[model samples]
Target: MKRISSIFCVALIGCLLQGCEKKIDLELKTTTPIIVVDGRVTNSSSEGSVVALSYTKTVKSDNSIVPLTGATVTIQEGNGTVYSLPEVSNGVYRNASLTGIVGKTYHLTVVANGQTLTSSSTMPTMVAFDSLVAEDFPGFGKTIKVVTPFYNDPPGYGNQYNLSIIKNGKLIKDVFAYDDLFIDGKKATFPLIYSRKADEFKKGDLIEVVMNCIDHANYKYWFSFSQSSTGSPQAVPDNPISNINGRAIGVFGAVTFQKRSIVIQ
Candidate 1:
């Protein structure tokens, strides 16, 4: 009798659960497209300055980017000299003669789609890279190899930096931003952490690192963008802080950088 009672109860519960089963379709809100500007000026004569324009993507639309072309782009030095960046390709403007100078400020002006946008950034002094050392670190049931860079943070506050990694001649698409909040005016060893089992370092692998000394505004933009991209718990689902104003979302960074390469042994 107890077995029969249990079977009946189980049948009754199944019927109740089937009655409660329902499908839910979520209606996500779509956002309007906005202008996105990516511009950079570096303190290297061998490299040219570039400003690329594009339209933002919406969830319902295709993920392909729509480039903004035929717009006026110019970079003006603090000394009142302006260099018009000619369009080398669609939606991309470049000025080969405009190299950033440390301690000098640069202003970017863009007129696109009948909207004007402008922003300014100052180039900070270059910090010397002392050495690059590759070390093995213990990982989850495996050994991980990473490159550690040694440098001295200059005295005073507000020193910001961005490091880009190039592995085997291909740029790693990650942002590594550092600030001198804890180790101000002190020697420090910061490790470059890029964990990919498929892209792990092997014998004779070449790794190049570019350490850029950027200003405070640029640091905030990069740090915020990194946090959002990594899906941090504290990150808000919004665009990163932009220095550019007037209907555009992006950053203009004047950076002084140094590059160094190391081979994994």
Candidate 2:
């Protein structure tokens, strides 16, 4: 009798567990497409200002963007001088005549599909670096060499910086930005952090460090964009706020570029 009771209890429990299982199908939400505009005007005359236009894609779709063509792009200075940017390639526009000038504000306007978008940015003064040094630093379980650039923060508040590292003429994708909030009016040094050992400088590798003195808006965009890109648990991932007006998603940057190069010794 005890064995029969135990067998009945086991059967009852198995039937209850089987009854509780169900499959759930969730409905995914879709959104309308938003226009994306990425354009920049730099102080370098040789490297002209360029703009690329595209639209957002759905989450379920393949991650390919459709490049927009036949759009009219123009840039204007604060003094009302306008330069038209011609389409060089599909969805890409360039204006070699629109060289960025320090302390001058630049305005960008784009007309596409009967919609207009606009943005403005001011080119900040260039901050000169003192020197670039490659020094040996203690790493995890070993010593490694890193490249650092030394510069004095200009004697003012609200100064922002963006740094880029190029190895053998290719730009690294690491995003580096700094603000003079705490280190105002002080000499600062920054380390170029690379992810892989293969990216580290060799004895004779040519490295170029390009620094841009950007405005506050540009600094905010880069800082927020980097945080969203890192996939951090603490970060609230969202699109970086666009400097452009209208329902567009992108930035119009006017930056001053200064570069320093060094061969690893």
Cα distance off (Å), candidate 2, residue 37:
2.3
Local accuracy of candidate 1 as per-residue lDDT tens digits, 68-176: 8899999999968999999999888999888988888999999987889998888998889888889998664688788888899988866778887789998775667
Backbone collision count in every prediction?
0, 0
| TM-score of model 1 vs. true structure | 0.80
Q: What would the TM-scores of all predictions be?
A: 0.80, 0.77
Instruction: Assess each prediction's global lDDT (C-alpha) against the native.
Output: 0.73, 0.72
* Model 1 accuracy (lDDT, Cα): 0.73
Over 4 Å off, model 1: 1-28, 59-64, 230-237
Cα-based RMSD of candidate 2: 16.6
